[model samples]
Target: MAPVTAVTEATRSWDPYERGCPSRDLLDRIGDKWSILVLGELAQHGTARFTQLRKRLEGVSEKMLTQTLRALERDGLVLRTVHAEVPVRVEYELTALGQTLREPLKVLTQWSMRHTTDVLAARERFDGRAGAV
Candidate 1:
């Protein structure tokens, strides 16, 4: 077997199809259902509190939301603000890079909404055939 070599970030051309590409990790993060919903909610509503986000995103657990926010913040796609007040306040908003993603995400959201019925029908057909086999 041939040994695989590691490509330095500086010299590596980012190709998501490459086996060791860092882009794959990023794609995986952004492709997550929670992450996509979080980004979409923030993009549409501007800054929001953690509770508000959780409420808006149905079925997302507190822990999952927290992890998503932390990951987004770490990726520079979201900003976390801390305001000192009586009880203190924290809000999440998208940064410039995150804003750049709005259009693409919006398109993806629309596509999903539009194709939902088609996708469900396809899934049913596939499942039916699988069950028969």
Candidate 2:
């Protein structure tokens, strides 16, 4: 007979710095620009239709929005619902798991907003130096 063992957080290994870590894949998914924007919209609005998402996320093409939604759904971060109506409406919302990410994403968004001026100034300085060289 084999002895039974339990897995705990201490026993679990997930290093994003490692080459083949699963956490790296998850980071790639959520770190994408489209994913961040889409998640931000769903976090703010709760539930939104395809068109509503498209409208809110300016410059996002239909294909990109569809791909982002499908990816989020596959990752279990978002829920997709299809309503049986004359027009067959579809809507998306954040799942409980996805809601857990809201605060972190919100903090990142705030940081970006707060640092835009500094970032732009840095970029301008770099470009000016590059032009002289």
Candidate 3:
């Protein structure tokens, strides 16, 4: 019989530079606009209902919100709870794994906010140069 081996940090570590790595897929999910916004809202509010999240996000269609939530849930980032009640209440909150991402996402949000004007200016300059050529 072959020898059994225990998993270590090196074995579980993710190298996004490698093609077809699971981390690449995870990066895509977390880097999406919808996912980032959803995570931000959840991080701030702790927990929220479907309608509440929809209202807070603004401009997000029901289908899109549902899809985003489902994807996050599948990735173990968000927890969905359905309460048995007269009205059947449902809510979503970030899981422990998701909580770990809060700080990094917050930093990213701040960075975007800080650079929005610069980014816009750069885009305008690029557009002008492109039009000149």
Which candidate has the highest lDDT of all? 3
Residue 78 alpha-carbon offset, candidate 3, angstroms = 0.4
Better structure of 1 and 3 per TM-score: 3
lDDT for each residue of candidate 2 in 1-133, tens digit (9 for 90 to 100): 9998887877887899988888898999999999999999999989999999999999999999999999999999999999999899999999999999999999999999999999999999999999999
lDDT of 1 by residue, 1-133 (tens): 9999988877778989999888999999899999999999999999999999999999999999999999999999999999999799999999999999899999999999999999999999999999999
Against the unseen true structure, what C-alpha lDDT does each candidate score? 0.96, 0.97, 0.97
Can you tell me which runs of candidate 1 are displaced by over 4 Å?
Answer: 1-12
Whole-model alpha-carbon lDDT for candidate 2:
0.97
Considering TM-score, where higher is better, how would the candidates rank from best to worst? 3, 2, 1
TM-score of each: 0.90, 0.91, 0.92
Ranking of models by lDDT: 3, 2, 1
lDDT of candidate model 3 versus the reference: 0.97
The positional error of residue 20 in candidate 3, measured at the CA in angstroms, is 0.6
Total backbone clashes of candidate 2, pairs 3 or more residues apart or in separate chains: 0
Instruction: Identify the superior model by lDDT, candidate 2 or candidate 3.
Output: 3
Q: Write candidate 3's Cα lDDT for 1-133 as tens digits.
A: 9999988877887889999988999999999999999999999998999999999999999999999999999999999999999899999999999999999999999999999999999999999999999
